[model samples]
Target: MKRGKKYVEAAKAIDRGTLYDVAEAVSLVKKTAVAKFDETIEAHIRTGCDGRHADQQIRGAVVLPHGTGKKVRILVFAKDAKADEAKAAGADYVGGEELIPKIQNENWFEFDVVVATPDMMGVVGRLGRVLGPKGLMPNPKAGTVTMDVTKAIQDIKAGKIEYRLDKTNIIHVPVGKASFTEEQLTDNFQTLIDAINKARPSAVKGQFLKSVTLTSTMGPGVKINPIKVM
Candidate 1:
């Protein structure tokens, strides 16, 4: 694809079945493809139960310095004090009870993340059926619900990227634009990997550093050697 040429080229340079291999494969194929492997871009062998099942599993999170290069629309659920705080903090959408019915009737998803205050959880809870499936639900575990509306809105605007394991226990997200320099892209990649390493779930026994690959939107993927990074 137009966005993946650089990642494809980088993968070709590795000349090994690193995480880059999956990236390269994805880049080369015309249709979207999924990669499964026992090693990470760093070439570290995955250990333990190998939660590679395409269902329940825990992965990690990453905060992309450059953000996802996509504009994030935030929906804040608050009233009075919190509502004012969100508006002052630059929230794209902020309201209370009325907002829920409007969203339900419109089925709008242009927004990326949703934030709600503790007091407003009951109202927001009513929209679980609508927001949960879209992964836009406001949950305390993901830091999407807080009393500090200012900080919540600031973090969303600051390029905070949340990652979770897919059905295959692998986390995927875009790190940069195609126009970004290799150095810039690599730095972003390293930052994400470090975060993932730090988030290793205790349930995952043994070597937690598994396989990793870097690819772009509709581009070839390249696997990086984990050892070189270790």
Candidate 2:
């Protein structure tokens, strides 16, 4: 496979030590180069850390450089003033009384995130049975419930990724693609790490961060030295 000139140029600019650190951070399990191939050359780093907890639990937020390559359908529950405010803010779905039943009937998971105004807590509270189990219920602690409907919608639409600590207390998310330039990936990786470190809960005594690793969908894992980023 022929590497793109841009990729080659990007690769050349990487400092060896920084590359090694990134390789460790991203956990590049396998490195291979095809002599003759039709596809573009790409590499994936797999970290040796389990992110199931991060994926399933770990409630925190991050704004992606490249918005979540998906359209986020927003549902807002507000009344009178805030209701109109949410709609004016460009929420895909907006309502008060009709919100719960609509969520119960339709596939609520279809939406990326749900936001509710302060007054809508009552409506949001009632749907706990339906939304809680799926981890879709908006919580005040997670900043999903706010009086700032405009900010909420804009932030979410801009690529905010939410994670919560589960029973195990681990958080995992895709930082970037193999096709991304090293610099681009590094920036994204740094942003995510910063978000995670700041998410450490006071209740979590001792090792707030047990260990860190970066891996791909299907790749070997590498252990990242947390100090490198600090």
Candidate 3:
């Protein structure tokens, strides 16, 4: 595939062999984002742990100091008072039995995040086939499956993000929009890196963070020296 002019220029700006300092990487990534629209800046981290082992899996969430710069639509699965609570907490959509059919028969899916009270898991479970693949399922580990619907809704609305390993043992997360300042991006990046380091599984015998890279939506990646970032 032919690379776009902007991408080619951005690629040329990077030193492919050098692992830049985290702060320097963040700055370079921002400078290389030549998209007309405000592109999102993301961090892609490769870990030493093996994804094939359940005990070695590293998964968690964090509330970035600066929000993701995207609006989040939340669908809450609750009943009666719980449903009302979700709405009170700014959930975009709240429902019970009606939602099941809406999502099942009508193929309803106009939301970004989904939160559910523990009691409603049985109903939410029915949509697993649909929601699971999209990473929209409300899992307890991500704090989306809980009785505290209000807190859960508020937390997610306040820039909370979940990170989990893929089949390659890599975790990709949005740090912030490219429009954010270097300080804001650095804070968010460090916050995420700290969270990942803190969640290190005992099974990871080697360096927990094998590699870290920062990039914008359409820019070439800037590799970060893991030692400097840690």
Candidate 4:
């Protein structure tokens, strides 16, 4: 893949061999962010655990302190009062069984996040094969499947993000936008790091966080001292 001019310039400014502190890494990310639009900044963490094991899987959600600078398009699978509650709580779309056919046939997937009431899980379960790979399926562990439709939508709108390990044992999570201040990004970084640290399973014994990289959508990644990130 050929590097874009702007990206090349940005890469030149970073010392690829250096492992910067979280604060300094964040600053470099912002400085190198040359996207015309407000691009999201994310942290990609490589963990020591084996993602192939169920107990070793790193998966959970957290509400960023500064919030991810993006509006989430929410879809709730609920019925009656719960549906009403979801709509009132700022859900962009709410539905029940009718949603099944829509998703099945029309490919009605214009939403970013999907939340479902516990009772609706069976209904939501039918769409698992469709939604799971997309990372849109609501899971209880991620707080996306719950009885409290209102709080679920509210928290999501407030920047609640789910971080799950990929097949490579790496977790990629957006911390904030490049336009956010270093302090705000740092706070989000701290929250995410703490959450990952807490989610660490006791089964394994190596360096929990093998590596951490922070970067904007179009910027070069800045390696952070993984030990210090905690």
Q: Whose TM-score is greatest here? A: 4
| lDDT-better candidate, 1 vs 4 | 4
Give residue 146's error in model 3 in angstroms.
1.4
* Candidate 4 residue-wise lDDT, 73-113, digit = tens: 99999999999899899999999888898898999899999
Cα lDDT for residue 89, model 3? Answer: 90
Angstrom error at residue 32, model 1: 15
Specify the poorest-scoring 10-residue window by lDDT in model 4: 51-60
What does candidate 2's lDDT look like per residue over 1-230, in tens digits? 57565445434433334324655444342222112322221222222234453432346678867654456788887778887888888898878777676677885455657788877788789888888877778877667899998888888887676766544445556565555555555666777777766755444444445455554433334455555653
lDDT for position 82 in model 1: 83
TM-score of 1: 0.74
Ranking by lDDT: 4, 3, 1, 2
Candidate 3 deviant stretches above 4 angstroms: none
Off by over 4 Å in 2: 1-20, 23-58, 106-108, 177-179, 202-205, 218-222
Deviation (Å) of 192 in candidate 4: 0.5
| lDDT value for model 4 | 0.93
Write the residue-wise lDDT of candidate 3 on 1-230 in tens digits: 88899999989989999999977898899999999999999999999989899889988889999989889899999999998888899999999777887888898899999998989999999999999888899988889999998888878888999999988999999999999999999999999999999888988897888999999998999999988766
The 0-to-1 C-alpha lDDT of every candidate, in the order given, reads 0.63, 0.61, 0.91, 0.93
Model 2 clash count equals 18
Better candidate number, 2 or 4, judged by TM-score: 4
